[model samples]
Target: MKHLLSTHDLDVPTVAAIMNVADHMSEINARSVPKVPALLGRTVASVFFEDSTRTRVSFETAAKRLSADTMSFSASTSSVNKGESIRDTIETLSAIGVDAFVVRHASSGVPVSVTEWTDASVVNAGDGWHQHPTQALLDAYTITRELGTGNTLAGVRVAIVGDIKHSRVARSNIDLFARLGARVTLVAPGMLLPAGLAGPGITVTDALDDVLPDVEVLYMLRVQRERMDAGLLPVGGEYSARFGLDERRARMLSGDAIVMHPGPMNRGIEMVMDPAELPGSRILAQVRNGVSVRMAVLFRLLGDGQLGA
Candidate 1:
């Protein structure tokens, strides 16, 4: 509960606690003003080495809602452009009395390193292909809210389809969903599956149809084109054609099954999902939950529920 570096570090109770707080935060969003002074004197520093819009803005808005001052330091305009190290930037920010840090780096373990170097508690927005803990939590919250209690994963099947090798979201969700009692199936072409992935009650498959009928949720991830050049994923249209979840694939699921995609969705690359259509789509819901979920995270990390009240 100290620093959220990875989902693997959180026990089931800790995850449940955060989700409960997120439910409280969801209630706050329905209020007239939707602002609190719980973190009035506190400050949150965001150090984003990677390009992002949703995660960064969500954290900023969350801190603001709690009345915490926010400082955003990205690679483009910072001393990082001058070749300054992450350690130097972290120390500089920490010396200024930051209460917490929300970091997203291109390299895995950077958040963990930041936690070691600074007194500020660190929340990992993302780290390479490692984890996006907050995203996983929000997705979990969305599922719980939609399905209600006892609707956890126990007998429900979930298919996480797309670039698993480069998807930090997939990695985090895989762990989180499994921990919450869901049966997870990671579907992707051979090269896209993460190396050394096994156990923890997950099944790996290249065939979409194999897991479709039983799946209650189809979680899609955008294929990382950048990883193709780096050799982590294969190139081309053929790969997507074979694996992408189009209308045809969408029809294969149960009538009540839901479809979810974390934003910056590849309209044609990941799936042929039309934003205007798709009845059970929860993509927009994820964005809305991001604000409330992040608000809960900031409130808890800052040591009070008043901020989100």
Candidate 2:
């Protein structure tokens, strides 16, 4: 694959290959120095049109860990604020010899469009409510690590909860989990789910409590209040009441089950209780693994595209 645009573009072997590379990256991250010369002299630029803390910092750290040079871009402070187009910004950076770009935009397909303006390989960090490939990668890695079931998530019961209609993470995970042979159930209010969302090995439900006991991975999603229509959630209290992962609902999870959440969370709304109290919570693990997953992606795209080569 020339570009990491969406999970829809990946098959099983490609996913496994990337995750194997992540295993190598994860080892590097565990070392005292946590540094490598794999990507020395190569430049990876982060061009983000949206605000982010985890993804932006995570990608920068990943590139640095591999000894790749990183360029940071913020739309608010860049020429974008001065009316320069995205094409101009990307072209400008490409002219300076960027080897790869980690692009995140509030608009869907921005990364795909960026490919036209630059010769560098492009990785979609997150775009609109379309896809967040790297997040899904880390999540799958964390799950597979926990299960000790090797690379595939086959037969794993994963319930992705909350704001499905507006979650790029949810969309990416559903495709990936299904590809890896996992059973995925989307838990949300009816309107939160996309209309006619269906696929093999996929399930949908509005009842979180009913889905809780059965799923091995209970993934909580941030409720995107900004993306919702007015009536979908009034006051946010009701949604929390029904779908939030409170202590009581968390107890429904079986022993050895795990809880996950993609970050910058809506604490009171998406999760009524602190994740610290949850026995098998993988939220911090997800963040820790994110850097390694991103490092693997950068290696695959910008380096020789081989593991341990």
Against the unseen true structure, what C-alpha lDDT does each candidate score?
0.82, 0.89
Q: Pick the candidate with the highest lDDT.
A: 2
Q: How many residue pairs of model 1 clash at the backbone?
A: 0
Query: What is the RMSD, in Å, between candidate 1 and the native fold over all Cα?
Result: 2.6
| Regions of candidate 1 where Cα sits further than 4 Å from its true position | 229-236, 304-309
Error of 2 at 145 (Å): 0.6
Q: Write model 1 residue lDDT over 1-309, tens digit each, in one string.
A: 567788886667666677777787778777898888878989999999998988999999999988999999999989899999999999999998899999999999999999788988899999998899999988887877766753255655788888887889999999889888888899988877767777777899988876877888888887777776687655556656777777777778888888888888777777665855877688888888888888888888787522222
Pairs clashing in candidate 2?
Answer: none
CA error at residue 273 for candidate 2, angstroms: 0.5
lDDT score at residue 142, model 1, on the 0-100 scale:
80
Q: Which candidate achieves the best TM-score against the true structure?
A: 2
- List model 2 lDDT by residue over 1-309, tens digit each: 678889986788888888898999989999999999999999999999999878999999999999999999999889899999999999999999899999999999999999899888899999999999999999999999988879899899999988888889999998898999999999887877898678889988889999888889999998777654566653477888888989999889999899999897788988899888889899999998999999998998888643222
How many angstroms is residue 189 displaced in model 1 relative to the true structure, after the best TM-score fit?
1.0
> How large is the C-alpha RMSD of every model relative to the true structure?
2.6, 1.7
